[model samples]
Target: MSMTSILLTILGIAIFVVGLLFSIAWHELGHLSTAKLFGIRVPQYMVGFGPTIWSRKKGDTEYGIKAIPAGGYIRMIGMFPPGADGRVEARSTSPWRSMIEDARSAAFEELEEGDEKRLFYTRKPWKRVIVMFAGPFMNLILAVAIFLGVAMTFGFQTQTTDVAGVQKCVISQSEKRETCKESDPVSPAQAAGLKVGDKIVAFNGQKIDEWSVLSDRIRDTIGPATITVQRDGQEKTLHAVLKKNAVLKKDSDGEVIPGKYVSAGYLGFAAQTEIVPLSFGDSVVRMGDMIENGVDSIIALPSKIPALWDAAFSDGERAADSPVGVVGAARIGGEVMNLDVPAQNQVAMMLFVLATFNLSLFLFNMLPLLPLDGGHIAGALWEALRRNVARIFKRPDPGPFDVAKLMPVAYVVAGVFICFTLLVLVADVVNPVKIS
Candidate 1:
């Protein structure tokens, strides 16, 4: 790479790293503030992991930054309840039992004389739930804010009714060839005198405003048709004979499905697209679509494991929608900065990437598994349910749910995550996915 290119790449990566750090700090702030609100003593609020680069002791909490910027945490007192004997019990010979005892011991390792009443597990179940849920909730807020900012100002690319291109001759989609044959029939669009830059206004005397609506109308017609277009500030009517031909299949949302063919009324022109600002309601609808797509990506993640493994360890191609890690995302941010577009567009694209990352963080951390925020929330809710049940039956309280006993499961989950991260790192270095 050239020196200038390298500098741009570094600048992009640096910007992304800054955004990542701020996101991490923001998420931890939610936990720290809520924990303090509920009178739970927090000892540390670190934005990253490994050796601390800087730190300051303020009141009961020590806030700091660490060397690694991948993830972060806030250390709350009494994360797990005491053993059945009403204490942090001794270590046992069994590995799982040892894991539980070690975790319980660490929860009280920084215990002071006045910390007994401020333990996290000693709070009401609802309060504990809020403390754990706040972190991921902060991420969701950040994602929504960033999305709205970009959608309302910088705008999103959308298809319009204007014509961008006109095919000279019709070609069957099943043929998968772009060359025009001498014996082939002229395209309906070209024969009807359609030209690039003409704005399609109506089809067969029916008014049309959106490209999808016009596309659907064109596909459903197969005989004589009248098209109304605005050309050079003048409205003109053009006639053509629609033909039934094999074309690419489109999904319900009007997006073309690649490599799939279906027989439909063929219109041989491509619609123009431009960045258009969206109103609040339209933006909200788009946001909902974005969130639904994110959830779908998460649900389909496990099925992509075999593909990821093959791409990382074998001579297999990496799919475009494969899961991306921090390093991969940073590289994409770099590419976005170097695009041949306006500076505002580049910045908007970068912010969108960061927003997507925050969304993923929110969704991933909310999985109901050990070592994730959702796991603790689930545990707290379960505790509340059982306690309420006991109260209803006039029985004794069940006490706090012993979450530390699941230390072995947490370890397994962490192990799997680490391995997956390593694999993604390897693939990123050797077979990186390029956005452009």
Candidate 2:
């Protein structure tokens, strides 16, 4: 890569890291604000992990930035209550028992005389659930707002029926030749006097509104047909006999697969694309589609691990749809900055990448696994359910579901996540995804 390209890539990565820090801080802010609003004592609100890089005390909370910029947290006092005998400190012979007690003791390490009423566990179960749920919900709200704003303002690239260019001759897509050869036959579109900028109005007497529908219709039909076009403020009809030719089939990313070819009706014209703003409902519908795709990507992540390993170690071609880590995403952002498109287009694409990242954060954190916000929410809900059932049956109250007991399981989950992250990191460095 050129020096300029390298510089642009570094700049893009820096901007993305900044965006990530802000996102982590924003998520923690949600928890801090809600906890304070509910009269809970939040001692510290720190973004990132490890040693404190910057901090300042404001009111009752000490806000700080940490050295490691991976993730963030807000410390809520009394996250778990003491044992049944009201004992905060206890000794155990078993290692697992010690782990549970250690976690419970840490929860009340800073307990003060007046802090009992302000404890997080003292709040109603529903309120505790909301407090825990607020963090990921904030991310979800931000993702939606960013998506809607970008769609309404910068808009999205949409293909239209207007002709952008006409091929000079009918060349098989598999051949991939730009210039016409000596024996190359004239394209049907050229022979029919079709010009660039002509808007396709109808195909074979059928009114066509969407470019996708028109393209599919043309590809399906190989015989002679009347095509109506709006040219120079006048509607005109042209008759042409489309030829059945070998064309390379493309995947979702619009890249031609090597062995994928289909005999489709060829009209040899490229459809024009324009940035068109969407209505609020349309934008929302598009957002739903993105959410669905994100969920599918997460579900299929494990299946991609083998492929990722191969791409990183063996001589394997990284699939275009391979899962990308932070490093890969940063590289893509750099490529986007250096792309030969309008500046506004670049800004829109960057916004899109950030929005998608936030959406993924929201989804990933909501998984009901320990060490995640969703896991805490699940614990609170289960506690509520257990308490209500006991009350109905006139049984003794089980003070709280000891989430601290699950620390061992949480450690296992954290280990798995760390391993997966490292795998992705290696794959990204070795066989990073490239945009063309």
Candidate 3:
């Protein structure tokens, strides 16, 4: 492969990792900060999984870096199963009290003493809910800011007619025989009553110097369009609809399938596009709308996950057109980087995808299943409610997080996520989505 291609691939992978790490860290920070604000005793703040490679003591919390790069966690006292590491137990006055003071107990055991430091459990219901929800909220805000900044800096690409002194339309030359045929269709020409033989033209009541000028006008006008072209010996104005056409892709077997989409007006003919400048305010508004749409789409994805998985694994026509994994996302990022557009535009497009991605993660993590953010949120909420109900009856809080009760479901959910990730990885490699 060429050096440029290699460079792009490497860059894409690096960017993907950086973005993922940053996003994950930001998410955990949300939880850490909120827990601290509530006066909860968080002894260990870790990024990623596996063994700790480095650590630093910061007040009551021991912040550390881990060996694994997948995900991170916050170690709040009295939460989860008792650790044999003696981090909490050794510090306790009595062995029995140490067992009771374990990290996991924070979620289940009602505080008999030291209630002041365990403020997460003591806070009002709304405060607790907000803390649980803050992580996803931070992600959403990050997405919006990234998108808006990228848009303002680069603006958006549109298939409009704002021509430069470049080849918009060129006469095809033949070397073999004396004759050559035009394979590309002219949508605008046909719509404007220009025949196969008619070539010279003026557009939008202005003299057309090149095809670029014509392209600019069409892009600027996406709704109703009017084109003035020379036909035979006279000029005429033809009313047309400038609806964006979907660019189709073919699979390895040469079958057309839905793929990366672009906005191109269908004037009943095929033509190249030109770049058009957008106002800063307009770009920002578009970016905001895009972020809103992304959030809406993410909120709707979970209900569709089962169907999507079925389509990918079953004998359905749409099975091949499934979601992608890390490899696929990197490939896509590389392709976007290779585009003949400004860096800002490229970043904007990537940010758009990332926004939707983060939003998807935010919603997905909220599901009340094992190993996901949603599971933790659900566990916390359930414990809170259970305690409140027991208090009304004048009973004591529950004792511990029953691993047996939760393990079965957690194992199943973890299996499903792993399987899905592998399946999507295979699909991404086999049927990579190519942007036209």
Candidate with maximal lDDT: 1
Per-residue lDDT over 1-436 for candidate 3, one digit per residue giving the tens place of the 0 to 100 score: 7899778767866777678767778887888898888777777778878888999998878888787666677765544544445232335575444434443444434443674457454555445556667777777777767656655555555533222222222222222222324753334434445444333355556666555456455545565666665556776666765655443433333233454434444444344344445467766566556655555655565564665555555643333324656677777777877777677667766776676567655766676776665665676677677878888999987633333236456767888788767766655666555564
Pairing residues by index, what is the TM-score of model 1?
Answer: 0.96
> How far in Å is the alpha carbon of 431 misplaced in model 2?
2.0
Residue-level lDDT of model 2, residues 294-343, one tens digit each, is 99888999998899889998887888888887888888888888998988
TM-score, one value per model: 0.96, 0.88, 0.62
Residue 373 Cα positional deviation in candidate 2, in Å, after optimal superposition: 0.7
Model 1 agreement with the true structure over 1-436: per-residue lDDT tens digits: 8888888889999999999999999999999999999999999999999999999999989999999999999999899999998877675899899999999998987898899999999999999999999999999999999999999988999999999999888899899888899988999999999999999999999999998899889989998899999999999999988888998899765778878988889879889999998898988888988898899999998898888888888998988888899999999888887888899988999999999999999999999888999889988999999999999999999999998988899999989989989988988877777886
| Top of the candidates by TM-score | 1
At residue 29, candidate 3 shows an lDDT of 86
Better of 1 and 3 by lDDT: 1
Lowest-lDDT window of 10 residues in candidate 3? 167-176
lDDT of each: 0.91, 0.88, 0.59
Candidate 1 — which residues are off by over 4 angstroms?
Answer: 174-176
Superposition error at 73 for model 2 (Å): 0.8
Greater TM-score among 2 and 3 belongs to 2
